[model samples]
Target: MADTEPEKTAPQEHVHTSTDYPEGAQVEIPQGWMYRSRKLGPITFPWYASPQSQLVLVAFVCFLCPGMFNALGGLGGGGQVTAYVGDASNTALYSTFALVGFFAGTITNALGIRIALSFGGIGYCIYTSSYLCFDHTQNFGYSVFAGFFLGICAGVLWCAQGAIMMSYPPEHQKGRYIAVFWGIFNMGGVIGALIPLGQNIHTTSNSTVTDGTYIGFIVLTFLGACLAWTLCDAKKVIRSDGTRVILMQHPTWKSEFIGLWETLISDPWIICLWPMFFASNWFYTYQFNDVNLAQFNTRTRSLNNVLYWFFQIVGAVLSSFILDFPGMRRTTRAKVVWCSLVVLTFAIWGGGYAFQTTYTRAEVNKGANTPLDPSDDYVKMDWTSHGYIGPMFLFIFYGVYDAAWQTSIYWFMGATTNNSRKLANFAGFYKGIQSAGAAIIWRLDGLDAPPPYMNIFASCWALLAGGLIIAAPVLLMKIKDTVSVEEDVKFTDESVDDVVAHKIGHEAVDQEKV
Candidate 1:
């Protein structure tokens, strides 16, 4: 059997100075059974074991898992009658997500990415089921409890995802890969949103989603878990150009923690981006509950949810082109994105502020002092009502803003390192901090005297502007054209230095110390 296998050959190195390496670099096809099984006459189908294939695999997994989760979340109040249960559930979910996410990489390294991912998928299933249980029994505690457990699972799963996404692609292709993954992941949201929109199309009253929607989410989420097991190990994944994806040998709990600590202390610039991380998921509460649920009836919320996720795909793809444009220098691209986000944040949030002034929770929900005049046209906004187009578009813009904001952050993190082990830690830190902010905001929203709607809107705007401002110096001055060999060698052991240094041409090896 061994003698019949195709012969393997040494892959020649193709060197370039910038992050974008030239296409068509020669690669010797591997002799392994997995690679050979995928071959045809002139073209090899996407081999299950290849990095590109694995990326596609992971993207689908996310599309099923978190993507579906996003759809449910985007339904405003998790498709519940009122926002309280959803708010409390999110508070529980993000609270534990913060703590576990910070150390999730350790679990990923110890158990391997597949196990972590499988564990991650479990949480979504439980969470959606809890909502189903709530629909039947009116037992909201189960939902909050499910949220707490899911948070832990999500931390590990997302950390694994970030490491794989950020490290799998060659330097210049990172942005494209992020966009592709994001587009697919958010598609889950689009499709999931459709489930509710179609099911409740006739529902004009304020109400919770039917049990069938939750069941659909649970089944899709379970399939994502099955997909997780199919992912090729990081070490075995070969890139299209036949370069080995970078990995640390013999990973252990001790080594993973040590590397995490070193990454934090050595790369102090990451601290500057904490505010940005904190602000990333902080606005979801306001967007979903305060705005969408507050303004629209059940059926209309479902329709708005679909548009939101669809625009997310649009925003992710658009940002990728700007970030990965072949003509511009990588550093120049970073600066341009920073400037654009600053402007976009102000413009979008300024519009959000204006929208918030028109209706308070009292006015929209028809609480005290709110007369239910038939001609008021301010309460219980339905999709068919007059003046619906403007608010709908504004909500869509918010979706785009979310996708671009998240894509830029991932791109920034990927710019700093190529080592998967080190990147795992970086990703963990990002999720942890982001979850921390989310937890605080979600908890606040659940409070009896929660901040006024305008105050919440204003805080989101202020934090976003401030986070971007804080991140500007690092984006402009610190990001390099490519990852330095020294940073890789210094963070990981010396074993990776030669391989990494050679992959990123010797001329560019020491260009940046980060």
Candidate 2:
């Protein structure tokens, strides 16, 4: 042929024969299949690589245990508060316990995932189970000790579980995962409320004193232990002696602690998230306290619990689904947060009005010397006339709003950040800030003042709402899209083959990386 160059020898295709593979290699579908699929892109929908069965099981167990425990604590707190009243020593003791929990969380954060989780679960089981021994006759010393131990356990459990959940799911899937887990967990609160209600009902039926509430705690503790075992089994490699030994090495220990500190201080996203998380905590704690306020106004403990459980279920379910909508996803995390804050403002204002009305009516009733029927609904100041409809509506609104905000924030955090170490550290810092906020609220309560409950509640809510509103715009402006790791790494035909080969060659490595 006129200018035909020597026949180009077909490029000799050299197969990659070396056994060595890139660290943390994952199996990927063939390029042909991926190219054919419309959704094949960097930010893969459904975030996680096909749901990890073991992880999902472990997560379910984790959710159940904490949910039950927290719910029980909510119920038990009222009784403990009543029992320890006017005991200055007990107040000091509660404070000390809370302080210990604060420190324990910091330590857990420094320890990394494996060690922290193992220790945390075991510790929680032991301390939480001890609740069975508590009673009205127990002195302030006992109450303090119980509270202290429980606090330590709770702190560790919270920190460890949070790290585990965040570590497992990719960023985009975080909202859905968190919402499902949290909804299940909050169900424990419902169960907890229900247990007491059941006990109350039984006591009413049998004409006996309400003495079997502790039984619920015992049952929950056992369930928690079983779940703890599952968690332990799920990650056997990390539990091995070799891993433990390596972690104890002085250099490793120092590196981990330093890394934790650095992560807390340097992360910009985490810094922005702290205030919002703090507000969330305040709102949650406030809700817990509202049960007592409801009881006081309605003079029926059963009504309070029933209303709470009802609203919590509704709110949790609604929030879970609503957050998944495209418009409300990661990009609108701040907007969700702001909406919660605004709703909280109205809720608290409504609560204050209710309180003021109750106070005025109480004074009138006291002056008149009439024997008040606790269950009477027609009293002008009775917020319970509608069976806590006012407070219930408020709680329902807050719960839904809170759920959406939490889902958005956590999802955004997990998706946007690539570093797992940093995510764990940020979680610790965020929780610590939450504890600090709770402490501030606790201190601000003028317990000695003349029924300043309404003022205290109103002021805190107003301030929290205002702070969130102010910060919302700033956070919204800073919000950005998440970058997918898959997108950044190019995938060619050969690369796809390599990935598939790697998975076949080393199943263990693929599992570990995923």
Candidate 3:
């Protein structure tokens, strides 16, 4: 029996290196798909097959659809959620974002990427469509349900997206891949940001959005769902070139949780990142969403989003290249990450400064003191709200901050471990904590508008500061003396393809004998 038995297959091993490889050198890419390049002129670079490239391209396109919808959805709050739902319903719409974010990750782990992203996208499509009914209804129930649904969708989508973005790229070129991924991700933000600009959202002081804007958002939201399917299925293990490595079957739920918890408890550095993970999304303006809309004016709101995304896309793309320059060392990227705290600090404190300096006492007082209603336009825009310049700076610098932290953290995780699936679990943990923090912020924001004089933005400086306190010490210890590192790229089409084929052959022989 022992002699007759088939030989067992070996586990796949991932290889990484720190030796600097020259940029654009011919490296072994594991992909099996190709794309035509039109960069030269009317003609093209012949189709180069690489499945990995296709995944990245599809992911980018998918991101834009949801990003645009998300941008437009921001307008729904503060009495604009719908005419009949009223200002109070803003709580339901805004808070759900935090509520479902992390939980979605667990579900993703259970359902795999395709279900997580597809349903999440579908959820957005429904949520966006529901906005069409906002003007026609007064029950508020539908609005609440839609908001909850969207929140759940957002949570899962972000979790799956983060996992894929971080894990799928080859070890050697993760920085550039991340940059392109995030750049495309935010490009959607830019498009969505511009949508509101056309609505001339600034023309009136009332909390209102144009119908055309709603139509655009709905169509775009559905389109994102369509593209969601174009990405690689999570049920398969895919290599850098988008070639299938192996079919991934579901593990028992018990083992999954056990593994997830083991990964979390075993890593102190990751645990350190947890607090800030929660704090990261906590600083946003939703707590003041309705009031700010009234006090600052729609132009300020729309333009801020537009401006935020523009610099963010640029920053995200550039940071990717800078972090991975030919001669750049790990120490350099580490330094940028450490420096991010300064921007983080300034960005945090700057929000309050902008709020205080931009508007008059009367405008601040009115937005804060008055009862919010769809028709109320008591608060006015201070053209001098150059104070928004603060967030603009933040949007720009935070772009750097986001680029640094997100890219660095993912890179750090990969550098620390060879297990891509394990890395995803870690991502889930981080995202879960992040969502919890965001949800808490939303929950609080929905409950009460921060005091008019307190600069709701000002009060949270402590939470972020506290988060940094935990994050900085751990990160510095881990990266304080980083060295330059790079992946020595190696791959060949037939050789790489043969590995998978060989494994399939073994499995086939075993099956045939059985």
Top candidate (lDDT): 1
Winner on lDDT between 1 and 2 is 1
TM-score of each: 0.88, 0.68, 0.74
lDDT of candidate 3 over 310-346, digit per residue (tens): 7767766766765566675664665665576556667
* Residue 315 in candidate 2, Cα distance off native in Å: 2.7
Candidate 2 lDDT by residue in tens digits, 50-100: 334324544555545555555543432432322122122223323443455
Those runs of model 1 whose alpha carbons end farther than 4 Å from true positions after fitting are 1-46, 365-378, 484-486, 494-514
Q: List the lowest-lDDT window of 10 residues for candidate 3.
A: 484-493
Error of 2 at 158 (Å): 0.9
Order the numbered candidates by lDDT, best leading: 1, 3, 2
Reference-based lDDT, each prediction: 0.82, 0.45, 0.53
How far is 152's C-alpha from truth in model 3 (Å)? 2.4
Error of 2 at 459 (Å): 3.0
**How does candidate 3 fare on TM-score?**
0.74
Residue range 1-514, candidate 1, lDDT tens digits? 4578778854533433322323333233344332222112223333665667888888899999999999999987789867778888899999999999889988887789899999999899999898889777878789899999999999999999999999888878989999999999999999999999999999988778988999999999999988899887776565654455566767888887877787788888999999999999999999998898878889999999999999999999999998899999999999989988998998999899888988875555444231111113345789899989989999999999999999999999898887787788888999999999999998888776678899889889999999999998888877888875445555655443234333332322222211
